[model samples]
Target chain A: MKPAMLYKLVILIGILITGVADAAAHTIIVHPSLKVKNISQALQQAHNGDTILVKQGRYAVANLGIDKSVTLLGEGYPVLDGQMKGDVLIVNVNHVIIKGFHICNTNKGSLRNYAGIRCESVKNIIIENNRFNNTLFPVYLPKTSHSVVRNNVINGSSHENTTAMESGSGIYLWYASDILVDGNSVSGQRDGIYFEFSNGCTVSNNRCKNNYRYGLHFMFSDSNTYIKNIFSDNGAGVAVMYSGHIIMLQNRFEYNWGPAAYGLLLKEINDSRISDNIFGHNTTGIYMESCSRNQFSGNNFNMNGWALNILSDCTGNRFDHNNFTGNTFDVSTNGSPEQNSFDANYWDKYAGYDLNKDGIGDIPYYPVSLYSKIVENIPYAITLFRSFVVSLLDKAERAIPSLIPVSVIDHHPLMQQYRKS
Target chain B: MLKIAKYTVYDIARNKIILSYAIFLLVISLSLFMLDNDPSRSLSSLMSVMLIVIPLVGIIFSTIFIYNNSEFIELLVAQPVKRSYILLADYLGVAGSLSLAYLIGMALPVTIYAPGTTGLYLIVTGIALTFIFTSIAFFCAVISRDKARGIGMALLLWFFFSVVYDGLLMGFLFLFNDYPLEKPVLFFTMFNPIDLARITVMMKMDIAALMGYTGAVYRDFFGTSIGMVFTLILLAIWAVIPLIIAVQIFRKKDL
Candidate 1:
C-alpha cells in the first residue's frame, strides 16, 4: 500500500476501535438489596468507561479505591460511610467523575489526613453536587491538576469539646494547580477551603463560615483568583501568606471578632490585587506584614477595630478610592511605613474643608491619630475609648501634626464616600 | 416636699439660663443631625457633646442655681419642713428640670434622626449623668458656705471626672504595660460615671469592635441586658449616695 493509504487506514482503525469501546460502555446499578450489594463488587464487574449507578442506601465502605477512568453516579444520593476507619474513596487514575453522594465519617482521630474523597496525582477529575458530613478532610486533592469541585456542602462534626483547629479542612488542595473551586458552602472545619502550594487556581462564590481557624487559607499559592466569597465568624478569617500575583475581588469578610482576629491577614505577600472587598465588624480589617506592591482599591473598610493595621515592614502598597467609615482607627502602625501611598480615599473622620466643591478635600487628611498609636503601643489603653481626654488628645495631635506618622497621609481625600460610578 | 419641689421646678423652668441652655442644646443637636448625612457619625459627635457638655451644664447650672436660691432654701429649712425634705426637694427640682431639658433638646432630635437602642441608651445615660452631677452639685453647695468656692469645687469635680481621671488612667496603663489591665481598667471605669456612660454607649455603637479584647470584656459585661441594668442601677446609686451624705450633713449643721 502507498504511504497516504497507510495513514488513512491507521486513522480509520483508531476511529473504529474507540467507536466499539463507546458502544460497549453500559451502566451497572448497585442497590442494597440487589445481588451486587457492595460497590467493590460492582467495580470488579465494571469496565474503564462504564458508569456505576448507586441507589439510595447505606454502603459501609472502607478505603474504597477507584483506579479506572469511569463515572460513579448516585441515583438518589447514596450514603457512603467510611465507618470512621479510613478514606471512603481514593481516586488514583485520571478522567473520573464522582457526583451526588453523601460522604461521611472518614477516620477522625487519625494522624493521616484521610478524606471522604482523596484524589492523588489525578487529572481531569470532577467532584460536584455532593454532601460531606462529619468528614476528616472532605475532598483532599494532592498533586491533582485541572479539576473542578463545585456545589458541595461540607460540614464537620463541630462538637463543642473539639476545637475547630484540630479538625481537618473541608476542601484541601496540596500541590494542585489549575483547579476551579466554586459555589461550595463550607463550615465547622479547621479551614473551609485550604490551598497550599497550589498555583493558578480559581475559587469563587464559596460561603465559608464558622470555621475554627481561617475560612480560606492560602500558603505559597501564587497566581490564584478568588472572587465573590463570603467569609464570616471564622476564628481568624482568611489568610494569604507568601503568595504573589493573586487577584482577590468582591469578597465579604465580617464578624471575625477576637483579640487576634483579622478579616484578611497578609504576610510576605507581593504584587497582588485586593479590590472591591468589604471588611466589616472585624477586630482588624486587613493586617499586613512585610507585604509590598499590593494594590488595594475600591474596598470598604467599615466598623472594624483597626481598618488597616499595616506594619512598618509593609511598603510600596497603594490604597486608593476606598471607603473608611465607622472604624475605630482608620490606620494603625507600630512604626512608620516607608513608601505606602494613600490617595482619593473617603474617611468619615476627615475634617478638612472642600471649598471648591470638587468632591475632594482641600487639605491632606491625617488618618493615623495619636490615640491609635497609644492604643497600638498599649492595647489596654483602648479602655479610654470615647473618653473626653482621648478625643481631646486626638484633636490636639491633629492641630499640631505631631506624634502620628506623617507618611501615611491622604493628600487628596474624597469629601464624599467612594461610589462605583 | 412635693409642693416645694414643684415650686422649685417652676422657678427653675422660668429662669432664662435654663431656657437658653435648652435652646442651645436643641440647636446643636439639630445641626449635628442635619449637617452630617450619616446618622451614626452624627450620633457619635453627639456623644462627645453629651460627654462633655452635659456634665458641664449639669454641675455648673445646678451649683449656680443652688447658690442663687440660697435664701429660699434657708427659709424652707427654717420652716416646719424637715431639712432632708428641703434638700431632697432641691435635688428633685434640679435633676427633673435638667433631665427634661436633655430629653427635649438631645433625645427628641436623636429619636427623630437615629432611633435605635444606642440612641435610647445615650438618652438614658445623659439623664443619668445629669442626675448624678446635679446631686453631686447639691452636695458641693451644701458643704461650702461661699458661692464662688462652691462653684470652683464643682468645676474641679467636673474636670477631674471628665478629663483628669482618663489622663491618670492612661498613665497607669502605660506604667503597668507589662501586666494585663483589662479587668483593672473595667474596675476603674466603674468608678467614673462618665467612663461608664461612654463605654455603655460606645458598646452599642459599631465601633465597639475597635476596642478589641478590652471591648469584648466590656460587651460581655455592659452589652448584656442584666449588665446594662446593673450599670444603670450603679449610676442611680452614684446619684443618691452623695445626696444622702449632703442631706446628713445639712441636717446636723448650725445656721
Candidate 2:
C-alpha cells in the first residue's frame, strides 16, 4: 500500500516540485593585510547569505568554525593549513558552501575524526572543487541532507599504517540523505567513500585507487546507486554489506589482488543489480555471502582468480549476458543445492560446439569444475591447483561426471566474446 | 625395450616386498578413512602420509631394487639389448610397480569412503610422486657403483627436495621481505619437485584462508588451465629428465 501510494504521489504532483535558490545579499573581500586578518575573523563578521571571497594566501590556523548561512569561496585556492591540529573547516549551520580551498595537514586525532572539512547537522551544503591532502578523513558530514560534494581531490597518508580501526577514508557520509558525490579522485585512504546509515545517494564518476581497505564501503545503506566509478589497486576492494535495492552500474574494479581480496564483496545484500561492469585483474572478481535475489548481467570478468565465489547459502541470484574471459576459474562455490540461472555468457573455458552457427553452444556449459569443488570444500586444496594430475582430473571429469556440483550451469553459452557499445 | 620392460614388470610383480607395499597403503588409507567420516579431513591426513611416506618408500625401494637387479642388468647388457633400453626398462619397471601398488591401495578406500575430487586427486598425485621419486632413485643408482653410496644419495636427494628446498624458499622470501615477493616466489617454487607435488594436492584442499595473501597469489597463478598445463609439464620433466640422464650415464659405464 505504501509503495503504491508513493508511486501515485510522485505521478500526481511531479510538476509541482521545484527548488528555490537564494541570492547573496552582501559580499566581502578578505586579504592578509585587511582588518580581518584571516578567514576566521572574516567569518565572524559575516551574516546570513553573505559571500566572503578569500584572496590567495597561505593561512596557518587552528580549526575554522562557521555558525551562519554564508558562502566561503576562495579566489585562487587559498591554502588553509591545519598545522597538524584538528579539522580545517567546520560548518555548524545550514545553507553553507565551502569551495575552491586547498585544505591540508590535519593530524589524525586518536579519539576524534580530524578532517579537512566537517559538517554537523547542516542541510543544503555545497562542498565542491576543493583539494584535501594528508588528512585522516576529508569531507565528513554527519546528520546532514540534500548536499553536494563534487570535483574534489582527496589524498591521505600511506595506506600501510591502516590497521588503526578509527583511521582512514575520504568523504564519509554518516546518517545523511539525498547527497550527490561525484567526480572525486580519492587515493591512499583506507576506504575512498564510506556510507553509514546514509540513503538515497548517488555516487558517480569517482576514481578510488590504492586504498589499503575497501575502495567503497556501503554499510546499512539502501537505495543508493554507484555509477561509472573506477576502483583500482585496493586489495580489500569494495564491500557492500547489509544493504538492499542498490544499483551498481558500469563500475570498473581492477588490480585488487590479495588472499582475502576481491573486486566486490556483497554480504547480506538483497535485490541488488550489478550491471555492465568491468572486473579485471582481481584476485576474486565477485564474492557473495548470504546474499539473495541479486541480478548480475552484462558484466565483464577478465583475468581474475576465482572470478565468482558464492557461498553455500546464497540463492535466487541470476547471472546473465556476462563475459568470462581468461579467468583462472569461472565459478567456485560451497555445495549449495539452491537454484540460480546462468544464461548466454561468453566463456573462454567453454568447449561446446555451436551446431547451428547461431553463436550459441549446442550443449549447456558447466562453469563449476570438479577441481573448483575440491578447493571449495577444502580451502587448503588450493595448493594442488597447479598439478598435472589435477589438470588430468579436470579433463577426466569433463569427459566423465564426478562429484562436482551441478547446481550452476550456463544453458545458452555464447560462441564468441561479448562486445558492448 | 618392450621385452625387457615386460620381464622386469613380471619379476617385480611376484616380489613379496611389492605385495606388502600395496597392502601397507591399503591398510593406512582405509584406517584413516574409517577413523574420520569427513572425506576431506581423511584426504588431508592421507595426503600428509603420502607426501612423507610415498617419496621415502619410492626412493628407498627403487634404490634397493636396482642394487638387487644389477646382476640381471649386466646380463641384459651382454645380450643384443641397448644400454639405454636396459636403463629405461629398469626405471619404468620399478616406477610402474610402485605406482600400480599405490593405485591399488588408495583406490578402494577412496572410492568407497571419499569418492570425489579429493579422492581422485590423492590417487593421481600419489601415483605421480611414486613415478617421480622412482626415477630420481634410478638416477642416483646409475651415477654411483657403490651400493651403499647409491641408497644414501637417494635418501639425501629426497630430504633435500622435501625439506631443504622449502627452507631455502622461506629464507629467500625473508631476505627479500621488503620487495613484493609474490611474483618472484611463484617462479622460484617451480624448481622443487616435492613442493610442486605437495602444492598440487594442497591447492585442492580448503586452507586458502590460512594461506592468506600468499595463498591468493598462488591461487591466481595456479587457478588457470595454462598454469595447470605448465606445472604438469614441469612434473613430467622432473620424472623424465632424470631417467634420460641416467640412460646417458649408464651407456658409457662398465658393468
Candidate 3:
C-alpha cells in the first residue's frame, strides 16, 4: 500500500474496531445455576453499555458498586438481599438503570445511611419498578441531577414497631436538581420523599402515607412543584420549610391528627402558589409561620382543627376564592394579621346575610374567633369545647367585634361554597 | 313505686309544655337536617341546640313539676309508701319522659338523617344530661320550701354549669397559662354534667382535632373502654348522689 493509503487504512480499521466493540455490548445473564451467581460478579464481567439480566433467585449481595455505565435488569423481580449489611447497590457512574428488583434488608442503623440503591454524582439514572422493603434508605441520590425515580414502592419497616427515627427516607435527594420523582407509594418511612437543597424538582402522583414524619418534606428547595399527591396519616403531613417559588396543586391531605401535625406546614416559604388543594381532617390544615407573599386560592379546608393557622409572622399572603367549611376554627392567629388579605371565601360559620341579592354577604366575615384566640393562648381551655359558656362567649364575641383580630376578615364573603369544576 | 311512676309519666305526658318542648325539638332538628345535605354539618348544628336546650328544659321543667306536685307528694306521704319510693318514682317519671322526648325528637331525626357514631353519642349524652339535671332539680325542690326559691336555685345551678362554670374555667386557664393545666381542666370537667356530656359528644365530632394535645389527653382518658366505663360510673354517681340526698330530706320533712 502507498504511505497515505496505509494511514487511511489504519484510521478506517480503528473506526471499524470501535464500531464493532460498540455493537458488541450484549446482555449477560446471571443465574444461581450459572457460574456468575451474584450481582458483583456480573458487574465485573459486564462492560459499559452492557445489560446484566439477573434471573429469579435470591442474591445475597451487599455494597455492590457499579462504576460502569450499564443496565441492571431483573427478570421476574429477583431478590437482592442486603442481609442487614451496607447498601445493596451503589452506582458511581452515569447512565445507570436499576429496575424490577426486590431490594430488601439493608442496614437498619442510621450511621451509614445504607440504602437499597444509592447513586452519587451521576446523571440520567433511572431507578424504577423496584420494591424496597425494610431498607434504611430506599433510594438515596446525592449530587445527582436529571434523574427519574418512578414507580417505586418503598416500605421502610416491614414490622410495624419501627419508629421513624430508626428508619430513613423513602427517596432522599440531597443537592440534586431537576429530579423527577413520580408514582411512588412510600409508607412507614421517616419523611416519605425528602428533598434537601434540591431545586426545580417535580414530585407528582405520589401517595406518601403512614410515615412517622412528614410525608413529603422539602427544606431549602426552591421552585419545586408538587402536584396531585396524597399525603395522609403522616406524623406532620408535608412540611415545606425555607423554600421559595414552590407550587403545590391538587394535593389531598387528610387524617393527620396530632398536637404538632398539619396538612401543610409552611415556614419561611415565599412566593408559593398553593391552590386547588383539599385539606380535610387534619389537626391544622395549613399552618403558615413567617411565610410571606404566597397566594392560596380555590382550596377546600374541610373538617380541620384550624383551617388556616396563620401566625402573626405570616405577611402579604392572599387567600381568596376558598371554601372553609366544617372546620372548628376558620383561622387562628397569635397577634394581629399583617396585610394578609382574605376575600371572596365561603365560610360555613359566616352568619352574615346577603341582603342585596348578590352572592356576597353585606357584612364582612371574620374568620378568627374569640374562642380560637382563647384556645391559642390556653390550649388546656379546649377541654371546655362545646360547653355552653364557650359557645355563649363565642356568640357574644361574634355579636360584638371583640378579642378576635378584625383585620383578618373576608370582605366579600360568598353565600355559597365554591364548587370545584 | 312503679304505679306512682306510671301515673306521673301519664300526667306529664298530658302536660302541654312537655309536648310542645318535644315538638319544638323535633321541628328544630328536622329543619336543621333539611337545611344541610351533609349529615355531619346538620348534626353539628343540632348538637349545639340540643346541648343548650336539653339541660335548660330538663332543669326548669323538673323543678317546676316538683313544686306543682307538692300536694301529690303530701298525699303520698299520708299513705304507707316510703318517702324515698315517692322521690325515686318522681325521678323515674321525670327522667323517663324527658328521655323519651329526646329520643323521639333528636334521636329519631338524627338516626333518620345523620345516622353514625356521632349521632349515637349525642343521644347518649342527651339522655345522661336529662337524668342528671332532673336529679339536681329534685334536690333543689326538696331543699327549699318556697316555690320561687326552688325554681330560682335550679335556674342558678343551670346557669352555673351552662354558662358560669366554663367562664370560671376560662379564667383559671388564662390565669395559669404558663402551667400545664390539662389535668386540672379535665378534673374540673368531671364536676359538671353538662361539660362531661359536651366532651363525650365532642369526641365524636371533627372539632375534636382542634383540641390538639389537650384532645390527645382527653382521647387517652376517654377514648378507651376503661375511660368510658369511668365516665359512665361518674355520671351514674352524679345522678344517684343528688337523689339519695333529696330522699333523706324528703323523709325528714314534715309535709
Candidate of highest DockQ: 1
Full candidate order by TM-score, most accurate first:
1, 3, 2
- Estimate the lDDT of model 2: 0.82
Give the better candidate number (1 or 2) by TM-score. 1
Give candidate 3 regions above 4 Å deviation: A1-22, B207-211
The sequence of per-residue lDDT tens digits that candidate 1 reaches over residues A1-421 is 6999999999999999998987768788999799888789988998888898999999998899998888999877899999989999999999999999999988877589989999999999999999998888999999999999999999888456668756898899999999999999999889999999999999999999999899999899999999999999998888889999999999999998887788999999999999999999898999999999999999999988899999999999999999999898899999899899999999999999999999999999889999889988887787788888898899999998879999999999999989988
Q: Which candidate should be chosen as best, given lDDT against the real structure?
A: 1
Which tens-of-lDDT digit does each residue in B1-255 have in candidate 1? 999999999999888778788889999999999999889889999999999999999999999998899899888877899989998988898899998888989999999999999899999999999999998898898899899999999999999999999999999998999998888998898899999898888878855364475667777888888998999999999999999999999999775
Better of 1 and 2 by DockQ: 1
Clashing pairs in 3: none
lDDT of 3 at A216: 90
Docking class of 1: medium
Better of 1 and 3 by lDDT: 1
Higher-ranked by lDDT: 1 or 2:
1
- List per-prediction Cα lDDT, in the order shown: 0.91, 0.82, 0.90
Q: Candidate 2 versus the native: TM-score?
A: 0.66
lDDT of 3 by residue, B27-79 (tens): 99999999887788898888888878988899999999999999998899889
Find the 10 residues in a row with the least total lDDT in model 3 chain A.
Answer: A384-393
- Model 1 CA deviation exceeding 4 Å by range: A1-22, B206-213
